[model samples]
Target: MTASSIEIRRLTAADAAVYRDIRLEALRLSPEAFGSAFETESVQPVGWFAQRLDGGAAILGAFRGGELVGIVGLMVADGPKRQHKGTLVGMYVRQAARRVGAGRRLVDAALDLAAQSVELVQLIVVDGNDPALRLYQSAGFVEYGLERHALKIDGRYYDDILMAKDLVGRA
Candidate 1:
């Protein structure tokens, strides 16, 4: 599929069912990539997922031929001292959707939304995910630090790479 065929937009509460499905898929398929586990989220009610979209966080989804194929979220910090910052989280593209520009579109849409309210956007990617590393880097995110053993799943330790992008001058 071409990049032009993918449509990116903010998710709403009504889209919760598909969001929950894809979210569980992401957590299940790449457990080490996220801090949340499939076992924990799989049991949550659909209302919980709907609240996630209705909450302050801005979650964007990529639709290919009207099917939700990818998602990314931008959460602006609410604290007094950190309101100028936002976090890019829950980024995932389905196996069938990878390499077709869904990932990049999701990131771009999230960053665009973030740039509106925050000067900086940060994210943590599990180390060794080269495609993710490249995607974030291509979007101007720079690595600031490494969190060793950031995720310990199934007795296996996985490091995380912390990245951030400054949105000082972007339009």
Candidate 2:
């Protein structure tokens, strides 16, 4: 599918079921890429997922041919000292949607929302995920640090690369 065919929108509680399905798929297929585990999130009720959409964090979804195919989230800090910062989290694009612009559009939408309330946006990608790393970098995110053993699954450890983009002068 072409990039022009992908539709990006902020998800609501009404879209929780599709969101949950896509989220579980991501965790199951790419276990090392996320901090959350499929086994942990799989048992949660749909209401639990709905609550996440209803929560303050901005969760954006990508639609292709009227189906939810990808999702990304942005969460701004609520504390007094950290309120200027936000974290980009739970980025995933279905295998079928790979190589299209859905992932990039989702990131763009999340960053656009983050720019509204936070001066900087941060994200962590698994060390070996070159596509995701390149996507973030191409979008103006710069590496700040690396966290060793950021995720441990099935007796294996994975490192994470920390990246951030300053929104101070972004239009």
Give lDDT: candidate 1, residue 168.
97
Expressed as tens digits, the lDDT of each residue in 19-69 for candidate 1 is 999999999999999999999999999999999999998899999999999
Clashes of 2: 0
Cα deviation in Å at residue 165, candidate 1?
A: 0.4
> What lDDT does each candidate get?
0.95, 0.94
Q: Write the per-residue lDDT of candidate 2 for residues 78-122, one digit (tens) a residue.
A: 899999999999999998898988899999989888888999999
* TM-score of candidate 1 versus the correct structure, residues matched by position: 0.98
Worst 10 residues of 1 by lDDT: 108-117
Report residue 87 deviation for candidate 1 (angstroms).
0.4
Off by over 4 Å in 2: none
RMSD for each of the candidates: 0.7, 0.8
Model 2 / residue 105 / CA error / Å? 0.5
Number of the top candidate by lDDT?
1
